[model samples]
Target: AQSVTQLDSQVPVFEEAPVELRCNYSSSVSVYLFWYVQYPNQGLQLLLKYLSGSTLVKGINGFEAEFNKSQTSFHLRKPSVHISDTAEYFCAVSDWGGGGADGLTFGKGTHLIIQP
Candidate 1:
């Protein structure tokens, strides 16, 4: 079984400031890590993912994350943020070897509040 934990429930940042959302996971077997973002009243959009081969992965909208096997972490970061970036961020994990029988387990979610 795999589980994801988001340390921060809310992150407040000024426009154009840098921000990072912390995430950690635990799994008995190898797993895939993902970050998803959801705007107000919208469905989740894939921000980034770490499936294999790379420790650092970049995604849409200037977002990036590093997979740290040692720390069991996949924290998401943005060099600079905009007001449009205000949304709920989620960290998720899914079994790497499963046949999609079990869906992804997601963290509670971090509300990204961008202050103008």
Candidate 2:
């Protein structure tokens, strides 16, 4: 079975500062990587993904992450964050089994607190 683990449950940062949310996964087969952001009482939006090609992947809202295969880690980073960046961030992965399954498994989620 595949699973994801978020290193931190919460990250606090001041407005205009930077932040990083750590994520790790365990899978026996190859898979796709994705990051999602969810605002209060809202559904998740795709932040970024690591499909094929470059390990460095960029996402919306000035967010980016690197796919490290050896470490089995994908850490999200934002150089400068804003107050509006406050939300819940999730690290997810999808399989390529073509089993037509839901193809999505997410971490518990990390609360991003952006201080004004």
Candidate 3:
């Protein structure tokens, strides 16, 4: 079984500033990690993912996350953020055996509040 934990419930950052959202996970077997963003009144969108190969994976909207196996962490980071970036971010994990059938387990989510 795999589970994701988002350390922060909310993150407040000024527009154009850098930010990092902490995420940790625990699993008995290897699993794929992902980050998804949900804007107000919208569905969740895939931000980035770490399945294999490179430890550092980049995704849409200038966002990236590093897969640290030793620490069991996949933290999201952005160099600069825009007001449009403000949304609810969720960290998710799924095992390869599931193959999209079981779906992913997600964290509680972190509200990214971009302040002026």
In the range 1-116, model 1's lDDT, one tens digit per residue, is 77889999999999999999999999998988999999989999999999999799999999999999999999999999999999999999988767756588999999999999
Give the number of the best model, judged by lDDT. Answer: 3
Per-prediction CA RMSD (Å) = 1.0, 1.0, 1.3
Q: Cα deviation in Å at residue 40, candidate 2?
A: 0.5
Model 3 spans with C-alpha error above 4 angstroms = 98-101
Question: Cα miss at 11, model 2 (Å)?
Answer: 0.7
- Candidate 3: residue 31 Cα off by (Å): 0.2
Please state the error at residue 26 of candidate 3 in Å.
Answer: 0.5
lDDT of 2 at 70: 98
| Candidate 1: residue 60 lDDT (0-100) | 99
RMSD of 3: 1.3
lDDT of model number 2: 0.93
> What is the C-alpha lDDT profile of model 3 across 76-98, one tens digit per residue?
99999999999999999988865
